[model samples]
Target chain A: MNDEAACVLFDSGHRACGGCAAAMAARLILDAAGKDTIVVSSTGCMEVFSTPYPETAWGVPWIHSLFENNSAVASGVVASLKKQGRKEKVIALGGDGATFDIGMLCLSGAFERGHDFTYICYDNEAYMNTGIQRSGATPYDASTTTSPAGSCSFGNSRPKKDLPMILAAHGAPYVATASIAYPPDFKKKVEKAVNTPGPCYIQVHAPCCTGWGFEGEKTVAIGKLAIETGLWVNYEMENGVVTKVKKVVRKPVDDYLVGQKRFRHLFKPKRNDAEIAKIQALADRNAVKFGIDITLKK
Target chain B: MAIGTGCTARPGKSRNNKTGSWRVFRPEFINEKCTSCGMCRIICPEGCIGENEEGLPVPDYDYCKGCGLCAEECPSEAIEMKKEEK
Candidate 1:
């Protein structure tokens, strides 16, 4: 493998469809973490794509457990390492399906217990691995297999569950949301979390090419647009207070919705601007609630 | 890859043509029936399919995961899928 290829976490022999953004996210993350990291991946795309019996692509100490217990297992690793006086960093990565929906309980328990690990949620907004099913992190008015948008209902009517808020409620030392589009910011967050004292949670926005119905190369662009439009906010809470904001002023969320097929249902003729507006309002609420420090472009 | 945005975002990852879990299948474009409409390239979810120097749609099989999405979404039935042995 060339030096450039060394950054990838998932390699050949895994079963990810063409244009898998989660795979890209996994690679970007591993690149940021460098080599001194042991990843505990929940039952999701990263685990499915990196480890398939005799043929494995993961270049680090990786473990694949049940869908909801990655955090618990990570806690175990942290405890064992602490007992052994090992200083290496441990990261637990999970998908939105695992993190926001099924694994939420275990994650909460891990955080509340103050495990010395960093839990990064590669949030693609749905269960992309299981045929594009809707998960708790899916945005409102976005169509999925479960939440079909039609004349009556636009899409997922219920807003995405506030995951970072929930993690913050656990009183964890650090809680932040990031996107793969912003590499510098993402890398910085990972470095910060690794160096920080207690448990840290970073929810990184990962766009799904097939599931979201966008061009594969636009994965990074779409992910960046998510944060730029405030559809997804990047912020961190330090010691229970929302102290640092990643991006201040957000673009209109429509730029993001138009790029994906999942939200295509809203672009019809007799359109539901109210639903779109409601989604924007939710983003605005996040800005206000989190007190984002918008940075003005010079 | 052309960088269209701020500061020319540096490219990441290896374009190493390693055939592992994912491999891109080359699209056999029938120039006779091809209307040059660009649907195959447009609908390519991977965006790895694009016009060559001759303006003919070509698939970058190195990154293509053989998803056959091009053949599935082809409008004119001009693109045929051929699976290559890894």
Candidate 2:
């Protein structure tokens, strides 16, 4: 391995699709967290792609548990490390399904206990590992396999669960949102999360080419659009206070929604202004909630 | 499958799988066009990009999956995607 490759903790191989943002997120997270860290990955695309039993990509110590028990497993790891007096960082990685839905109970319990660990949720917005099933973190009006838009229907009827706020409500010292579009910012947040001495949570918006239905190459662009359109806000909360947020001039939500095939139904046959307006309203609400809009003076 | 020490395997053993065969479009690094911004290196999903001397980016095609991310996200348009002959 070259010096550069030696520095990359998450080595290439295994099997993530071309242009997978989750894969990029995994690499960046490991890069920021460093080698003195143990990652507990829940069952998801990341877990499936990065580790295939005998062959694994991770250069650091890594483990995989059940789908909904990521935090529970991480809590156990943290306890064992403390008992041994070993100082290795523990990071629990989960997809949206594992973090936002099925594993919420375990995650809640872990946070309440205040384990000295960091939990990173690669929020691809759906269960990409299991054929694009709708998840709790699925944004409002996205066409998932379970929530396909059809006659008398607009995509997913519910909005994305405010997971960072929910975790922050548990009195976590640090909770933040991130995206693959901004690599340095995401890496900085990861570093912050690992250094913080509580159950810090960071939900990174990883655009899925297969699920979200965009060209593989456009993954980073799509992530950038999500932030610029105010659908996904990158903000940090420390002790339940908004410490920092990535502000944008703000583009119409349509620019972000128009490209993804999941939102194709919104444009075809006729432009569903009403549905698009509702989606736009959701972005507006996020902009207000996070104060992400930048007012250009003069 | 011989499982050792709680079914342990060598770290970074996934490197055995050459993923370059998956590429339909290959990125040709244009030295003249490249300003060595290193955007392709940081943004590569596979982490297959390496830095040569003088800080130029050289992608290890053995694992480059032809995601076109480097070309698409290139600030100076230094990397161009060409149809893979092989």
Candidate 3:
């Protein structure tokens, strides 16, 4: 394939932190979507970085709206384009903070209305742009600015709200969870979402560097580590049945947490082994719940 | 500009069976600025920093999270964060 055509979707001048996984995900999805794509971005890191006033990293038609209205805006774009007889592909992207939290109503409305668009959530697990605040996508027991571990608290007390399930419940034709760590699988999912009729949603696990308190260069490594540890799983749902895309087996949660300072408190002497165990159990439960082959036990 | 060792680069593969197989990014240390201090080793979340036989800091990339804590905390600006090759 021509890399130049793919390269034009997102320019290198965007302001995302060094090695931002969302940038990589945006690049890959827009590459697969090709040149005739129109992207509607929410008020998140991707939006702020890619379209900073005088400069825009997006090569295709791009729009930025309120934090929670990216989906609705894209739906409007799709409607306007349809009315104008424009067949160009339409995509809406937002972080989990926007999609699962602030923008839930708008997103749900768009999905329920069955907008002919693809809504991709770059799930970095928090509102990284506005200073690593907790969102609905933040995993339980993980510390965030909003959920700092303290004398009286155990980090975020609630499990990450299952977003793909919510989208599936909206009767979306396609919904999938992807990670930048697994590119081929993510590409396939993107292609599927683009081709599927009606509304589609793909939540990509884009590991953050600056917000996660790690070096910018570890984007790809952290991406893979996330999936290996089951904190982020590569899976898809069609008609509400979840299926794991077994590119690799699950790994220990500690293997994923050791790199980021956000989880540093967990590793300290107070040693919330129960919290860590809960996270591991969540992974195990997902494996069993979704038929993921642990591919271990030797 | 090559930051770290690339001998075991995975190319298209994902898993590496060998121990210390995960991509190792060697941190660049400016000896003139380093004071034989241990801050780089202390802030390392992965516990990958080690002292060489001579007591200089060395990053064990096999377990190093690539978090760059050493680079951030170096008071003397001695550690330059470099990515180890795959």
Candidate 4:
């Protein structure tokens, strides 16, 4: 075992799939947060893979409670730290299932009380741990095991829940949405969230290969496409004000949808133009809301 | 590895499971064409690529799952994915 190789906070050899975006997100989060951090992970894919039984990939102090109570756990940790006069940074990590569906109450309560901790949700869009179930973060019209698109069904009908905006509504000191494709941006956001004094929220768009039906190597590219198409926006919100946004000359949502198998039904058996247009409209709304469209000077 | 009372395990012990055997295509780091840009080290999902003394990327194959992310994201085209045998 090389000594310097151990320098990486999130060590390899964990059971995360090849080119797993959650794994990459974990590495980047620890890289930004450093060793003097306590990670309270909710029961999710990361918890399942990184710490199965007795093994763990985390190089920092880590803890795992129930799926719906990690934010609550972090709240307790924050309160305990305050009592002990400890300065260690508290980061509560969860997937979209835990963040959007199961743990929303705990998350809201923690932020409402203004706990000095950072809650980072790696949104892979669905529950990839328990066999690709439909999650609240699932994009509009994307197929999953539970919400399979067939002759009658058009997959998950609801658009991704605006989690960052919801967290920002809690008067968080800082809130940001990021993607795994932009590592530097993500690292910077994590650093900012950890260093800030009040409760912070960061929702990272981590593309899952096994769930999304893309090749493992195309994880970063898929994530990039999501942003390039305006389906996923990368922006920072500080005290309910938009401070920064990653603007791009938007591409058609078709370019992003065509790559993933989840959206295969949209293209196959003659193009579902009407349905596709609705998804495109969602992206257009995001562009208009964030004003992320950058007109390239020809 | 003795876990302490009430399921307290050692930090970073996932190293016990060597994931190298899971690779179908192995990435070969080509030092000749390498610019030492360190992009491969930063972008690797496995986090197995470490820098050698000369600042070139060296992959710890014991844990590298050969996702070819480094090869795909390499700006200098220094890393190549070769078919693995046995």
Candidate 5:
């Protein structure tokens, strides 16, 4: 689909935040899948906000399934299509909470069964739909409603789950990590996933303006910072083998974290260099693992 | 409208819910400074901006929620955000 047509598929009249990364990602995903696609969305912010009672923004055949069963629903749809000898593509959509936490079991089962579908997880880092609570996808030291930073506690103590790698381990035909900062790269990955056979998983680093505590206009900028800092590495794995990686221009993690209110505690009153360093180390490790050239140029 | 488990309205019913009232700041387009790059129209959250005969963006203020995204992403600074006079 072209740019103009893509915009029409995911109507902007829906109630998304001023600069919603998930909304943009949805448009890109649907555009890649084209009109002959069936979308299955899990119960989350995207589902609730897009399809309120007596209104819908989606222009395709969309279904709202339980939070933990969207993948199962997509699998069923794929199976039905195959039985009927149809060529319609099935795309399963879910937020980080649903994909990494609630719906992980069903997703794993679908992947194991080698279902012909694409599961896209919009990783906004927390359970924004449930009032910004901490989830398995929340990065380390990030503050959330459930993981508030206090005198003794330092927000969320654990790191983000390696979701794409886990999906790759399942021997998915295609697995990728994408960011909303790069629209062309994201669009290409979605299209590739849609056309690839068997189970494909694409995790998109979607930033939430309200939940992440960033200015509405800074949504795309924040997403770029995440990629540049190597905190959100972009890579693709095919059949359990790494095939592609987006090299980062290496920046300190502080540049990415200091913009969002969720990480405000790390800089105010007294700068927690130790915590910041730990996060930076995580970025460094990610760059190395993904073969991203982070070497600073003189 | 009765609340249900799924979407009940005919598709595209969201167009009926004019969200312009939600805006606290409105984006004013400066046609002279615009290069007709269409970046604002592409990044606009409302997708209410359209090009006129001159290729300058003309926003449908009745549905725009004053997101200011157009002003922020505008490469030429052709769009400026002005506080709405409630």
Candidate 6:
């Protein structure tokens, strides 16, 4: 790798698909954490693709733990580092399946004990590693392998779990939601989480081009649309209190859902106005609940 | 080449695998139109794009899989993707 390319701790030339937002987020997080960092990844896309036996892409010290125990492993690493008086940052990386479902208990325990580490969940909204199955983080009415939209069904019937709020309920020092389209904001949150002296959680909205049924090049644009439509709100919380929220220009949720093939069934021969309206209501509720400013300034 | 788990001492053995042949489209950087914004370097999934002495982004084509992300995210439109000439 060249000098500039080597600056990022997450080395490239892995098996991630082109225009992968999760890959971009990983690079941003590593760049923010600097060299004195150790990463613990779960058994997911990030771990499987980045370290296939002998060929590892990470430049920093990295470890791969089981899908359900990365947070617990990271906690142990933090404890050992603390005992040795080392100041290296410990980051637990996982996808939504590991974070919101399988690993929730260990993550809660880690946060409850207030381990000095950062936990980043690359929320692609489903289990992309397992052929795009539905997870607890999958959005409502979105199609997935397990939650297919057929004649008798409309995809996932349950809403995405409010994981950040649950983490905040543990009294985490820092909690934030970010999207890959806003790199500066994402990097700043990562830096802040690493610098803070307790457990921190940052959930990043990483668009999955292949699983989400969008063109590869539209990853960034899709991420932006998610934020613009209030479908994915970006905000920060410190000590269980909301601090910052990214304002939106208030596009309809249809604008965000129409592009993805996952939502294609909702707009096939005719637009599912009722389902679209329900999705819109969810976004509107989020805008109001999070106090997202929808005012457009000239 | 069959090494036991936790026995192999050598790291990064996959460096021998050249992945450039996976490209369906290749990025062509236009020097004059380049503003050196460095966005392409930051956003490249493969991290194959680096800065030269002039601080312009240059792709190490040997590993670049022609993701076309550089072309898509470039504000200056300095990079264009052309069909790979097989």
The TM-scores that each candidate's chain B achieves against the reference are 0.64, 0.87, 0.61, 0.86, 0.84, 0.85
Candidate 6 chain A, run of 10 with poorest lDDT: A1-10
TM-score of model 3 relative to the true fold? 0.76
Give the higher-lDDT candidate: 3 or 6.
6
Superposed Cα deviation of residue A199, candidate 6 (Å): 0.4
lDDT of 3 by residue, B1-64 (tens): 3546734232221112122343355567887788867655433333345676676777655444
lDDT at position A136, candidate 4: 96
Put down candidate 6 lDDT per residue, A1-298, tens digits, no spaces. Answer: 1335344477766788878888888888887888899999999988887887778878888989998999999999999999999999999999999999999999999999999999999999999988999999999999999999989988999999999999999999899999989888998999999999999999999999989999778888899999999999999999999999999788889889999999999999889999999999999999999978567667
Off by over 4 Å in 1: A1-5, A8-14, A290-298, B1-86
Q: Candidate 4, after superposition: displacement of residue B77 in Å?
A: 1.8
Alpha-carbon TM-score of each model against the true structure: 0.76, 0.96, 0.76, 0.96, 0.93, 0.96
Candidate with better TM-score, 2 vs 6: 2
Q: Give the DockQ (2 decimals) of all models.
A: 0.06, 0.64, 0.02, 0.60, 0.47, 0.54
Candidate 5, TM-score vs. the true structure?
0.93
> What tens digits encode model 4's per-residue C-alpha lDDT throughout A216-296?
888999999999999999999999999999999999999999999999999998789999999999999999999999987
- The deviation in Å at residue A181 for candidate 2 is 0.4
- By the TM-score metric, which is better: model 5 or model 6? 6
How many Å off is the CA of A296 in candidate 1?
6.5
Task: Give the per-residue lDDT of model 3 (tens digit) for A55-109.
Answer: 5667788778898788889889999989999888888988989999999999999
How should the candidates be ordered by DockQ, best one leading? 2, 4, 6, 5, 1, 3
> Would you list the clashing residue pairs of candidate 5?
none
The CAPRI quality class of candidate 4 comes to medium
The per-residue C-alpha lDDT of model 4 at residue A47 equals 95
| Poorly placed runs, candidate 5 (over 4 Å) | A294-298, B1-12, B52-55
- Which 10-residue window in model 5 chain A sums to the lowest lDDT? A1-10
